[model samples]
Target: MNTKKQILALVAFSSLFISCTKNDIDIVPQNYTIPDTYTFDRNSTTSVDYSGQSSRISMLQEMGDYYKTQATAGNEVNETVLNNMYSNSGNPFSSTDLNTSGKQLKDKTAASTDYFTLLYGGGSTVEQASVRTFFQTQFTQGNNASLGNNAAVGVAGKYLDGTSTRLFAANGLEPQQVVLKGMMGASFMDQIANNYLSVNKLDAGTNVIDNTNKVVEAGKNYTTMEHNWDEAYGYIYGGDIASTNSFKFWSSYINQVNNDTDFNTLKAAIDLAFRKGRAAIVANDYTTRDAQIAIIKEKLALVPAVRAVFYLQEGKAKLITDNGAKAFHALSEGYGFIMSLRYTNKPGTNNPYFTKTEVDTMLNSLISGPNGLWDIDNISPKLDAISAQIATKFGFTVAQAATVN
Candidate 1:
């Protein structure tokens, strides 16, 4: 036979050999099929209640406004309002306290259940205790002129004390406003990106199958894996996907990113990634499932990283022009984003891309001077370094990230 004919004959023979062996053994290859689409049952017992979390966040904003109005009017601070705002006893945000019903925010202590305590205290007990103490101190002290103009806005707004007035919205938001904004990216966004959607947690042994089949709770229909993925999804879009309120967790940041065309694409990609991952879980295709999880982490990490770079550049430009107020405002946001880098979940890494030490070092570089940002000259280099570190960690260049926000 000619060379071509010989090669064809050999390939045919090999195929026959493999087929005969399989037939003789009566063995079948593993099924690893991936589904084309999946429908998430929002009412499934396994599904997370994002609307409830959103309500808590809204209550936080209302609490801030209430305190602001009370302080602004020079009215005596009501002890009941303070208790309800900080604990689950009388939440103005919900007719029924979610904490008591074992709902979304349930299991959280009254002292640790409030938005401020939840955001600052969730990761660290020390921070939680400190936040609780801080809240008490602010309210007990009442609205005092000695605390300065920002403090005069309200107890909840005291976090904004010494912050630049330019950071305040034209309509006015307390320091809690910035804190809440930062927490959206830092806490809520991070929880979805890192903790729940983490590949390590998802693919732990047979967790993909076990968790999906084993309903830990008697009444819940969701497997551990299914519930975990839904919880992650809840943090980003919550129960209502169409709503775009500025106070909503992911919607708030999405609105900001939608202003940029490139970032808009990235944002859409995140939505797709989340859906695909959830569907993959249903299909039992671990390969596709983990891939989507990685995509979610990488893209979500970029959101905050890009914003950090943008704010750093904006802050630098404002400082160079001697607009200290705007500079501090921008830098404050940048600081929050920097702090958020520690929450990104990377495969094969126990820790986040950026370490706490690295974040602190960068933060100190920007605000350590006698006058802080005001006295610091040419902070562009420090900002650039931070941007570069984040970019390098994520395998991207600063140029690509700078335009995202």
Candidate 2:
């Protein structure tokens, strides 16, 4: 045989030998095929489902919409209502599906095994409750500010930047931006990188066996392992696949940063990684599956790190121009992005780029003075320093991530 023919024959013989020898797991041969799209089938039926993740994404979308309207309508935000919606209790949503979905953004916020358990002191209910309560408090303060005219030093109210009006707390942080951004990290990013993709969830008890045997869960189309992977994927690419309208939180921000030429292909890279990982799971190619997981975690984590620097840079330039409204809006976003860094997975490790303590200290420096963000004299240097640290950890420079849009 010629050299090419001999090589092909050897590969075929090797695949057959490996397939026959493998007993504990159903390992696909080197020639195993992976689908171009995220679709899998068993017995001629579709086997992918991530409805629960989709519901929670929608819940956050609805919650954000409701919060934004409160100040504009001259209405006081209700803490009880916000809490109910967050916990998915008391039928707070207008959508009947969400009211009955039994899924809330609360259980998932900072709920990842890696970071959540550590930050909450080994899953302490007290710490979790405090975090929820703090969110409600901030929402109330920002919404209540709408009852007055524009905000001033040590005041909470709306501020007009150009033609747009934004509400802020007494210290200059916009509650909407801060809370939403923080959740993007604490809930979505944490769950994706630190929870579902982690071995704690993927390779947990019986996951390998269930995946290898294609053992579908009771009344479910996919196996538990497959479902867990789908849930992670759903958090970002949920809702309508055709429209960006369905994008919220992490989904929205990923696309936002992808617009920059430096990271223009990020969306495609993440999508391919998710698709390949899912396909690898089906093919029983654990090696490929794990490799894809690393890709997904590293790339997805970069979203927040890059944005944290981007927003801080934007806010810093506005501060130099003495534009309070724009500066505060951008910085509020920066605060949330920084808050998210604690949830990021630092490839091949169970730790994040920044610990919760590091993130909190960085956050404190931004809103340090009596007037917090209004303490303009003390803010610029802090923004620069924070941006540098975040960039350094992620192996990127401040100038690269903080590129102007």
Residues 82-120, model 1: lDDT tens digits: 555656555444445543533322122212211223332
The true-versus-predicted C-alpha distance at residue 323 of model 1, in Å, is 2.2
All candidates: TM-score:
0.66, 0.88
lDDT of 2 by residue, 1-405 (tens): 999999999999889866652133657767766677778787889887888888888887777776677756656667668778889999999999999987899888867766666442233456556666767787687657777767888888887655446788898998888778888877888889888887667877778877888898998789988989998988887765554365667777788878888888888888888888888888888878888988988888889999999999899999889757668989999998898887788777677778767988999999999999888888889999999998888888889888736
What is the Å distance of residue 98 in model 2 from its true position? 0.5
Residue range with the least summed lDDT across 10 consecutive positions in model 2: 118-127
Clashing pairs in 2: none
Candidate 2: C-alpha RMSD after superposition: 7.3
Candidate 1 lowest-lDDT run of ten:
106-115
Deviation (Å) of 71 in candidate 1: 7.4
Q: How high is the lDDT of residue 28 in model 2?
A: 75
